[model samples]
Target chain A: MRAIFLREFFGYFRTPVAWVFLSVFLIASVGVPWFLGNFFESNDASLRIFFRFIPWIYLFLIPAVGMRLWSEEKKSGTLELLLTYPVSLGQAVLAKFLAGWLFIGLALLLTAGMPLTVAYLGDPDWGTVASGYLGAFLVAGAFLGICSACSSLTANSVISFVLGLMCCLLLVLLGWNVFGDLLLSLNFPVPLVDFLASFGVLPRFNPMVDGIVAFADLVYFVSISIFALCFNRVVLHR
Target chain B: MSAPHSTARIEANGLSKSFGEIQAVRNVSFSVNPGEVVGFIGPNGAGKSTTLRMLTGFLRPSEGSASIAGIDVLKHPIQARLRFGYLPETGPLYGEMTVVEFLRFVAGARRIRSVELDGDLIRVRKVCHLEKVWHQTIETLSKGYRQRVGLAQAIIHDPDCLILDEPTDGLDPNQKQEVRDLVNEMAAEKAILLSTHILEELEAVCSRVILLHQGEILLDESLEAMRKRHPLFGSVKIRVAPADADRSLSVFGKLEPFVERIDRQGDHFLLRSRDKRNVSDAVLAVSKDAGLALLEVAPVIPRLEEVFQELTRPQSKFIEEQG
Candidate 1:
């Protein structure tokens, strides 16, 4: 597992994907607040505006990171070589997931300029900033897990990316009002809609952005990640 | 370092695999003793790769079992895997990593202790001639260099048994020779099972050859025994003028009762028979009848190529069924 983690983590930098992902993510995370969110004009000392665009950016970026995790290995036939080693399938999957998640975490860390800039200009709400970062990490992990699951379902990276995008889109839509309105209009059970909305990422993520660290929200994101990883294992076994 | 073991280093019993409706391998059973090189030879779709994959634990066998160094592969995969090195047909590699980094990663993955990694890696690099490309990324290296890197990774742990599938598949003659030489050098210490369709590859390195045809074992014997047991053995070769070739062929064709096969080569004809009966008299009589002069005639020794062809021929199935 250690070996796989090292190889996969360093592998991202071997190509342009890691660099490109970091730049795009950093620029979007910081630039969105400065140019559109009125970071300077509002005189608000919190990173709440910056946190709003994370889910939308991650919906595409996390897939890009996770899409090749298994698909490239399968296509290049390296997965056979990998599995034939002493490592178990579960170990391999965990190592790959952690590496991708850590990579996204590293990208998140690079955007430290955002909070630092907020701190430089005024007294920033450090608690909210920490919560926001934590929430973004959880969201990235969940999205990465889903993308990795999609990657295991096929040998084509493009198909894996598109599949991952669709899956993440569904999870994102689950929390949005449009989906609930559509379901309500269609005369679905109100209890069912309420239960699913609670499961969506937005419900858990919104509170974290507001410095509200609920145990239930933490459980929600962590469970979604664990479920995706379990699904990945099942797909590979088949 | 090259001491031999008394027990079989690699063993498979009644192994079989099926992908949905297709039964790719059927009851394949074989064993390799230490210091012995076994060649798994077969035609395309003959279950060579499937059998190797099953033995390596990359693909689970639907029935039966395999063991390496006395450890059951399925029951204890990591233990079994630790004892053997396998190179699939493609020699799958990490294109982004430098040769040294890749080798280091394999060593680490195989769980080699940090203390021994440096020494083992140095020895493997020397053995594989990878010193030149140590720092070069795998994708930039030539195919031969990449194959060597693949080989280096396989042997980094110094396994007791090695299973290679078409190790020389796409290599040039020089690279193939290099791989063959490496196999021969390593055979003194490790039990080796090589899967290849190339006949000469077996002849070059294998002491024993397992011939598979259509998911069944057709022949399992030592090279010397195979050569001697071939029906083409003790055959006679005769050469006559081009004009007499037609008449000589006709004459030899008439002796179909005595000849197994009559192979023609320019003005030369090779007459094979299952029995040691001297057919020279019949050939002389035919030459006289046809008013042809025999240029030369001599006893011919069958080659490994002929033995392989005879064992793998479609008609051999009928013969085996009848027998």
Candidate 2:
């Protein structure tokens, strides 16, 4: 398991995908706050603006990091070799998922300079800033798990990327006003509407960014990640 | 159940796999003992790869099971896999990594520690003749060198068994000979199963041959036994005088016990005999009775190609019904 982790971790740098993902993520996370959100003016005690945009940022970058996780192995026919090793399918999936998630986490850490600068320039709510980073990490982990599962189901990296994006988009759309309004007009039961709303990205993620570590929310994201990873193992075994 | 300790390095019993409606392998079974080189020969899409995959536990068999070094592969695949090294057809290499780096990865995967890493790497590099190209990236190396790198990784763990698929594919004649020599040297201790389309390679390297076709084992025998079972009798060419032709033909008819069949062309007789050992005795008897001189008796050895063709010929309805 350790060997697989090291190989996969270093393998990220051997290809252009990791670098491209990091660069794009750093530029977007940092650049968007300065150019679009006007980080210096009307600054609150919180890094609310940056946290607000992370879901959109991860919508693009997480798939890029996860698309090649298993799909490349299938494409190159190395999955056979990998499976033949003395490693269990669960261990293999965990190693790959952790490697990709850690890569994105590293990129996110590099962008910490933004919040540090915000603190240096004006008083900022360090708790919200820290919670926001934690939320981003959890969201990235959840999306990465989904993308890794998608990658395992196909040999084409492009198909995996597109499917991952679609899945993430659907999850986000579940929280939108348009979806809720449509559900209200359809006269759906109140419980069903509330249940569907809980399925959305914001309902679960917004609490984490506000420093509220609700057990249900934590379970929701962790469950999704575990479920996706286990699904990946099943597909590879089949 | 724990496997009984034995010299056998690999064993399979009625292993089978099916992909939807197609049966890729059906009750295929064989074994390789330590220090023995076995050749697997079959036509394209004949389940050689599928069988190898099952042995390595890459694909779960739909029925039956396999084992490596007494470890049940399906029940404990990781344990079985730890005892064997495999080289898939395409060599399954990371093109971006240097040859040395790839070896290091394999060594680490096999759980070789830093203390033993240098020695293991040196041993594998020396055996595979890969020292010169160690620092070069795999993508930049030629196909032959890449294959060498693949071989290096396979042996890096010092497995008790090695399963190689087309080990000599895409190599020049000289490179092929080098690999053959390396395989020969390694065969002294490791149980090796190699699949190849090249018949001569089997003759040169393998002690036994397993001929497969349509997911069935057509033949399994030692090289010497196979040769003896289908021995190539020498062709006897005799030019007889027209007056003595009838007598010579009569003598040839008496020689049917020693000969497979005979063909006639004018006054010439071409006799294909099964008794290559007593060729001179048969020729002497025919010469004395027919008053015809023994012109030529040359031995035509049968090549493995001819043996393979004859063994794998499509079965007719009569043969199928009998089975």
Candidate 3:
């Protein structure tokens, strides 16, 4: 597992994919708040605009990172060699997942400038900024897990990316208020709608962004990541 | 051929695999002992790769079992895998990595740590002749060099057994000879099971040959025993003039007691001998008695290509009866 992690973590930088992802991610992350967001005008001394764009940025970028996780190994015939090693299937999956998550963590670390800039302009709430960063990290893990699971289902990288994007989009849409409202209008019970809405990324993520570290929200993200990783292992085993 | 050791290093007992509804291998069984080089020959789609995958713990067998050094591959995959090295049919290389990086990764994965890793890498590099291209990227290397790297990775762990699928499939003639010699050199220490369609490769390096057809083991015997069983072994050909052809036919029939079989084609007579004795001398004696002129007399050498064809051809009388 350590061997796989080392290979994969360094493999991203060996190609231009890691650089490309970081460049685009940093630009979009900082750019979203500068031009479109009411950064200076709101004068609220917080990083709400930066946290708001986290899920949208993760929805697309995580798939690009995760698409090649298993699809490349399958197409290049290295999966046969990898599986024949002295490691189990679960170990291999965990190694790959941790590598990708750590890569995203690096990208998130680069965006430290956002919160620092807010603190320079005015008295920004440091607690909210810390929680927001934590929230983005958890969401990135959840997104990457789903994308890696999609990667194991196919040998084509393009299809893997598309499937990963669709799954992430679905997870995001589940938390959208309109989706829950639409179900409620069709005579669905209130408890059922609330139960389904609780699984969405937005609901679980909103509290963290607000500096409220709820136990249920942490459990939700951890459970989703675990479920996605297990799905990845199952897909590859078949 | 040397007798196989009682302690088998590689064993497959009634192993079978199926992908969905299509059965790929069925009840195939074989064993390779230490210091033995077994050649696995088969036509394409004959389940050679699938069988190797099962033995190497890459694929699970639907029935029966495969063991390496007496460890069941399915029950204890890590221990079984530690005993053997496998080179899959595709050469399983990470093209983006340099030869050094790839070998280091393989070495680390095989559990050779920092201090001894360098020593192991140097040893494998020397054995595989990879010194010149050690720092070159795998994608930049030629196919022959890539194959050498693959071979180097397989043996880096210095396992007791090795399974190689088409190890020399795409090399040039010289490279092929180099690989053959390398296999021969390695055969002294490791039990090697290699599959190839190249008949001469089997004849050159394999002490025992396993012929598979339609996912079934057709023949398994020592190379010397297989050659001796050929009908053309120790056979001699003779030519006579048209005038002496009729007298030569009668004389040849009388000489059948000293030979195994006689085949007649026009003025040429092919006489197979049962033993190493000179059949041509007896034919000359018969010719002298009949006053027939003998034009040509030469021993015929049986070819391995003919043996492979004879064993793998479809709808043969022997296979039909077995069915």
Candidate 4:
């Protein structure tokens, strides 16, 4: 398991994919908040604009990082050699997932300069900023887990990327006002409608972004990540 | 049943696999003893790769079982994998990695840590002739060198059994010879199961040959036994003048005691006999008695290509007939 983790961790930087992902993510992560939102109306009291765009940014960036995790191995015929190693399928999948998650974590850390710049410019809400970082990290882990499962379903990287994007888009759309309206018009049971809405990414992640670490939200994200990783292992074993 | 000190490296019994409607392998059973080089020869799409995949635990069999050193491969694949080194048909390699880096990764995967890595790398490089290309990226190396790197990684762990599928698929004549020599050297301590389309390779290195056809073992015998059991053995060709051909040919049929069969084509008489020595002597004596000039007399040994064609042709006919 350690061997697999080390190999996958180094494999990310050995190719140009890691550099490309980091550069594009950093550009959008910082550039959009400062220029498009005008530094949150020049107030700098909170990272509201940055936190608002994170789910959107992650929709594309996480797939870029995780799509090739298993697909490339399958296409190159290395999956067979990997299976022949003395490692369980679950161990291999978990190792690869952790490696990709760590890579995105590193890319996210590069944007620490944005928070530092805000701190230098004005009295920003440090508590909110810390929680927002935590929220983004947890969301990135969730996105990676979902993308890892998609990656294992196909040998084509493009197909896996598209499937991953669609899966994430579905999760993001579930909690939107439009979806809630649609469910209400159908006259669905209130309890069922509320239960479904609670599963959405926004509802579960909103508290964390607002500087509140709820136990239920933490359990929800961790459980989804573990479920996705277990599904990835099952697909690979098949 | 487990033996603490048994010597068999691989054992399979009634192993079979099917991908949906297509049955790739069926009712196949074979075992490789220690230090034995068993050559697997078959036509294309004859389940050679599928069988190897099952033995290496890459694919689960639909029936029967495959065991490596007494550990059931399907029940406990990791243990089976630890006991064998496998080289897939495509020669899986990380093109972005240098030869040394790839070897290091494989060693790591096999759980060889920093302590024994240097010695393992030295032995693998020496055996695979990879020292020259150690620093070269895999993508930059030629096909033969890439194959060498693949082989180097396989043996880095010094597994007791090696399963190689078409190990010499794309190599020049010199490279092929070098690989053949390498396999021969490795076979001294490792039980090697090598599959190839080239018949000469089997003849040169393998002590025993397994001829597969239509997912079945058509023939499994030592090289010498294969030659002896071959139906075309003891066949000879003789060219004689037409003047004495009639008389010489007339006596050929009477020499059936030493001949298994005979075919006459104008002035050339093809003779297949059970007793090669007696047939040659009788032909000499008859030609001398009739004063017939014997132009050519030589034994006709059937090539492996012919044997393969004969084995596969019957199966094709069967399929066509069933259709």
Candidate 5:
């Protein structure tokens, strides 16, 4: 497992993928809030705009990062060698996922300049910033899980990327209040609509973004990541 | 050959694998012992790769078992995997890493670490002739270097058994000979199972063969015994004068039991035999006794190609029909 992690983690930097990905991620992560969100007009010390664009940015970039997780191995015929290694299947799955997650964590870490700038300029709530970072991290993990599972389904990285994008887009769409209201207006029961809405990314993450670190949201994101990794195992086991 | 060696280092017992309704391998059982190089030959889609995958613990057998060094692969895959080195059909290597980095990763994965890892790195680099391309990334190297890197990783742990699928598939003749020599060098200490399309290479290296056809083990025997099964095994050819052919035939009619059948070639009459024996002397004396002048007399050398074609004819026919 450790070997797999080391290979995958260092693997990202071996090619230009890591540098390009981090560059695009950093620019979009910080630039999106400064231009689109009311970053300067709000006149507030909080980084609400930055937290708002986290899921949208993650929905695209995480797929790009995770698409090659299994697809390259499968297409290049290295999957055979990987599965036959002395490591257990579960360990292999987790190691690969953690590798991608940590690399993304490093990307997220590079954006610390944004929060630090806000803290240095104005009286900012550190607790809320910490909670928002946690929320975004978990959201990245959940998005990574879906992409990893999609990656295992096919040997073509493009197919995996598109599938990952579609699945994550569906989850993001369901999180919107208008979509939930549309479902309720279509004669769906309140509990059933709430149940479906709870699976959305924002429903699980938005509370944490608001500095409300709920236990259930944390468990939900972790479970979603676990479920995705298990799905990765299933596709490979076949 | 050589009494089939001693302890079985690689064993497959009643192994079967199926995907949905199609059965890929069925009840395939064989063993490769220490000090034996077993050649696995089969046509494409004959379940050769599937069988190797099962033995390496990459694919699970549907109903039976495979063991490496006496450890059941399914029950304890890690332990079983540690006892053998498997080079998959494509010889996949991590293209992003340099040769040294990839070797270190494989060594680490094989549980060889620190000081031990350094020794293995030096050993495999030397054994596989990978010292020149040591610092080059796998993707930047040529096909031959990539293959050598693939082989270097397989042997890094110095396992007792080697399972290689078409290890010499794409190399030039010289590279193929290098790999063959390496396998031969390793045969004294390890049980080596390799599959190949080149029959002459098999004859040069393998002591025994396991011929699979239609997902079943058709023939499993020593190379000599399998070669003997070829129809042209002991056949001989005699070139006689065109006018003296019929007279030679009359002279040869007395040796019917020794020569099972004789057919006319362009310039020679091919004498078929039931067993491989010294019948050239008999033919010479018979023709000399009748005063029939002979132009030439030669015996056929049995080849694995003929035996392979004879065994895998049905599949060959299908391929031709498709074309």
Candidate 6:
């Protein structure tokens, strides 16, 4: 399992995918806040505007990183080789997921320079910044888990990417008013809509930006990761 | 064929597998003992790969069991997996990694660590002749080198058994011979089962063969026994003087019990018998009596390709019933 983790963790950098994902993400996460959110004009110490753009960024970029997790193995026929090993399926899935999660963590880590620049400019609330990063990490983990499961469903990387993108798009849409109204107008039940909306990351993520780390919010995101990974295991089992 | 003895290293007991409405393998069972090399031959989609997958525990059998070194593959897959190495179809590998990294990763997965791991890697690299491309990335190497690396990883642990699915699928003739040599070199100490559609491959490697067709075991016996199943198992050829050929043919026409079909070639007479019989002496006796000058006379050995077609042509069972 350790060998798999090391291989997958380093696997990101072996291709152009990692560098492209990192550079794009670093530029967008830092650039969005300054150009569109008016980071300098607001004259604020908090990184709330920066944290807000993270989910939008993750909604697009997380799938790109996670799409190759199982799809490539399936395409190259290595999935059979890996499953036949002495390692259990769960262990293999966990190792791969953690490798991808940590890769997103690294991408998140590279954006830390923004906070340092904020601190240099004004009196930044370091706790809020820390909690915000944690929120972003959890969201990344949840989205990555969904994408990894999507990758396990198909051998074609393009189909895997599209499926992951659609799933992540639905999760993000569950919290927004326009999507909620659209579902309600389609004669959806109120309680079911409320239950679905509770699974959305933005609802749980909004408070963490103000340094409010609710245990329920953490549980929700963690459950999403576990559920998605469990789904991945079940698909491979079939 | 009868089941192998209890000491067999790799065994499958009444294995069956199905995909939805279609059955891929049915009630198939065989075994390979130590120092035995078994060739598995079948056309595409004949469940050859399916059976190998079940034995390796890559696919669970729908209604059967497999064991490696006496451990049940389904019940205790890891233990069974530890006793044998499998090279799956396509020789799947991570092409991004160098040959060294690939072998080391496989060794680590198999729990061969520390100093022992290094030595095993070197040993396999030497045996597989992969020393030239040890540090080269797999994608940069040719298919032949990649296949050698595949074989190297399968044998790195030195397991008691080896299961190779089309180990030399796409290699040139020389590369194919090299892979065969590696398998033959290791055949003396391990139980080996390899699948191929090429009949001539069995000549250099396999002691026995299991012929599968449409998800059933049609034939499983010694290579010699399979050849004996050829329609013209004991055919004979006699090169005679053209002037005496007609008289020789008339003489052979009376040997009704020995000759099934007699064909006249330019200066030769080809005789196929209903059963295996010594017709060479009969021909010589007839030639002497008929005053024919016999240039050459010898028994004809059946070719593997002809024998394979005889046993496994489409609707072979129908052909068998008629025969």
Model 1: how many Å of interface RMSD?
A: 1.0
- What candidate 1 gets wrong by more than 4 Å, as runs, is B1-4, B238-299, B317-322
Task: Count the clashes in each prediction.
Answer: 0, 1, 0, 1, 0, 0
Candidate 2 per-residue lDDT over residues A144-217, each given as its tens digit: 99999999999999999999998887777787657887998999887888888888888778877787767888
**What lDDT does candidate 5 reach at residue A159?**
99
Tens digits of lDDT, candidate 2, B119-186? 99889888888878889888899999998988887778778889999999999999899889989998
Instruction: List fnat, each candidate.
Output: 0.75, 0.55, 0.57, 0.68, 0.71, 0.62
Q: What is the TM-score of chain A alone in each candidate?
A: 0.95, 0.94, 0.95, 0.93, 0.96, 0.94
- Candidate 6 clash pair list: none
Q: Could you tell me how far off, in angstroms, the CA of residue B136 lies in candidate 5 after the best superposition?
A: 1.4
Worst 10 residues of 2 chain B by lDDT: B314-323
User: lDDT tens string, model 3, A85-125?
Assistant: 78888999999999999999999999988878878888888
Q: Report the backbone clash tally of model 3.
A: 0
For residue B294, give model 4's deviation from the true position in Å: 4.2
Q: Write the per-residue lDDT of candidate 4 for residues B221-322, one digit (tens) a residue.
A: 887656654455667788888776777777777777878787888888888876444367677777787678888887777676666665578554323422
| lDDT scores in order | 0.87, 0.82, 0.87, 0.83, 0.88, 0.88
- Over the stretch B75-119, how does candidate 5's per-residue lDDT look in tens digits? 998888888888999799888999999888888888886878888
Q: What is the C-alpha RMSD of each candidate to the true structure, in Å?
A: 4.4, 3.2, 3.2, 3.4, 3.9, 3.2
* 2 versus 3: better TM-score goes to: 3
Task: Give the TM-scores of the predictions, in the order they appear.
Answer: 0.89, 0.91, 0.93, 0.92, 0.93, 0.93
Report the CAPRI category for model 5. medium
Model 6 is docked with a DockQ of: 0.68
Q: Considering only N, C-alpha and C atoms within 3 Å, which residue pairs clash in candidate 5?
A: none
Which parts of model 5 have CA positions greater than 4 angstroms off? B1-8, B240-247, B264-267, B284-295, B315-323
lDDT of 1 by residue, A1-238 (tens): 8999999999999999988999998888888878988877887888888887788889889999999999999999998889888998899999999999999999999999889888998998789999999999999999999999999999999999999999998888888777988999999899989888876788789889999999988888888899999999988873
DockQ of prediction 2: 0.66
